[model samples]
Target: MRQPSRQGVEQALDRVMRVVTRTPLLPMGHGGAQAWIKAESLQRGGAFKLRGAYNRMVQIAPEDRPRGVVAFSSGNHAQGVARAARLLEMPAIIVMPADAPAVKLAGTRALGAEIVTYDRATESREAIAADLAARRGAVLVPSFDDVDVVEGQGTAGLEIAAALGHVPARVIVPCGGGGLAAGIALALPDAEIVVVEPEGWDDMRRSLELGHIVEVPADAPPTACDALQSRRVADITFGALHAAGARGVAVSEAEIRAAMRFAFAHGLVVEPGGAVALAAWLAGRLTDDGAETVIVCSGSNIDPAAFAAVLQEEK
Candidate 1:
C-alpha cells in the first residue's frame, strides 16, 4: 500500500474545506493558556467525520457509486456516511451498535441511510458491513483506517492552520482511532500534534509506545463516548503521526465530565468526545504553564441524561 503522505492529505483537506464549514477556535476563558477550540461539533451532520465520508464518496467510480456503500459505526461516522451518500444520491447501509446514542442513530436515519442494528456482544460489525457490501455490490468504508478517510480528516488541520494564520506552537486533538491526529499532522507538517484520550481508552498512547497498532480488550467497562471507541489504530494514521513526531496523553473520566459541563455552561454544546481536548487542557496538558494550544472539539451528540449528569457533577 502506498504511504498516506502529508502532501496527499493536504489535497484531500483542500477538497473537504471547500464543502465543510470552518468550525471556530474560541479561546478558553480561564486564562490558563492560549486556549482555542476547533468546534467541529458544529459541523454538518454534527461531526468532523463528514469530511472523510464525503471525500471518499466523491472519489468512488461512477459505476461503483450506483451499487451504493456500507459502513459500521457507532455514531459520527454513521451520520457522515449517511449524509455523504445522500449528497451523492447513492444508497447506504449503516451498521450501528444497538446501544448507540439515539441522537446519532436518528440523525443517520434522517439522512436517508438504512440502519441495521448489531448486537455488540453477539455480532461482528465488520463482518456485517462486509457482508452487506458483498451482497449489494457496494463499497466498504471503514470509520477511520482508510487513507482517504485520514486525508479527509486532515482537512480540519488545514483549516486550523489557515484559520489561525499558521500552525500554533501545538495542536491538541481528541484521539480515538488516531485518524484525527493523523490528519492534522499531515495538514500542518510544521506544527507539533498531540493526541488526547480518556484514561482507559488510550489506544494511540499504547500504540505509540509499542511502536505498532494495539487494541484495548472489549471488557474494559465500555465508556459512553461512542465515537471514541475505535479499538485499533490504522497504518495510515501510524505513519502520519510518526512523521509529525506526535505524542499522546490521557485525562481522567472525572476531568472529561467536568470539561463537558464547563463548555456547556459557557454556551458551548460539546459532548464528551468533543470536550476531550478541553478535558486534556483542564488536566494541565494545555495550561499556559505557558504556551498557546489549539484543541479540536470534534463532536456534539451528548445524551440528554449524560449532559445533565455532567452538569450535576463537579458541584
Candidate 2:
C-alpha cells in the first residue's frame, strides 16, 4: 500500500476545506503539559469523517456517480458518507451494526441514505457492504483503508499545523481503523503521533506494536465507543503509522467516561470513541514529554440520554 504523502494531504486540504469546517484548536493545560484540543467533535456529521467522505465522493467519475456508493461504519463515517452522497445527489447505502447508537442510526437515515443492519458479533459489515456494492454496481468506500479517504483525513493535520504555525511536538489522535492517525503522521512528519483506543478494542495499538495487523479479540467486552470498534486495522493505514514510528495507547472504559465528563466540564460534547485520546492523557497513560501537544477530540455523536448518563457517573 502506498503511504499517504504531505503533497496528497495538501491537495486534500484544498479540496476538503472548501466544504468542511476548519475545526477550531482550543488551548488548554493538560496533565501539566501545554495542550490544544482539535475540536473535530464539532465537524460536519459530528465527526472528522466528512472530510474523507466528501473528498472521495467529489472525485468519483461522472458516469460512476449514477451507480452510487456503499460503505460500512458504526455511525460517524456512515453520517459522513451519507451527508456527502446527499450533497452530491448520489445514492448511498450504509451497512451498520444493529447495535449502533440510536443517534447514529437515525442520523444516517435522516440524511437519505439506505441503511442495512447486521449483527456485529456474528456478521461482517465489510463483507455485507462489499456484496451490496458489487450487486448494485456501486463503488465501495472503505472507512479508513482507501488512499483518497486517508488523504482527506490528513487535511485535519494541515489545519492543525497551519493553526499552530508549525507542526506541534506531539499529536494525539483517537484511532479506530488508524486512518486519521496515519494521515496526521503523513501530514506532520516531524511530530510524534500517538494513537489512542478503547481498551477492549485496541487492535490498532497491538497492530502497531506487533508490526502486523491484529484483530480485536472476538470476545472483547462491549464498549460505548461504537465508532472505534473496528475489528482490525487496514494495511494502508497501519503501514503509514508504522513508517511514521507512531506510538499507541489504550484506555479503560472508566477513563473514557471520565474523559467525556471532562469534555462536558469544558463545554464540549464528546462521544466515547472521540474521548479516547483525552482519556489516555488524563489517565497518565501518555508520558508528559513537555511537548506542545494537540489532542484530537475526534467526534460528538452520542445519544442525549446516553451522554447524560455517562456524565452523571460519580468520579
**TM-score per model over all chains:** 0.95, 0.98
Q: What is the lDDT of residue 275 in candidate 1?
A: 80
Question: lDDT tens digits, residues 156-262, model 1?
Answer: 88788878887777888988888778888888888778898877788787788677778877765556577887767777887678767888888777788888887
Candidate 2 has an lDDT of 0.92
The best candidate by TM-score is 2
Taken over the whole model, the C-alpha lDDT of each candidate is 0.83, 0.92
Model 1, residue 113: C-alpha shift (Å): 0.2
Q: Model 2: runs farther than 4 Å from truth?
A: none
Q: Taking the tens digit of each residue's C-alpha lDDT, what string does model 2 give over 6-83? A: 898898888887789899999877555668999999998899999999888899998889899999999999999999
User: Measured by TM-score, how close is model 1 to the native structure?
Assistant: 0.95
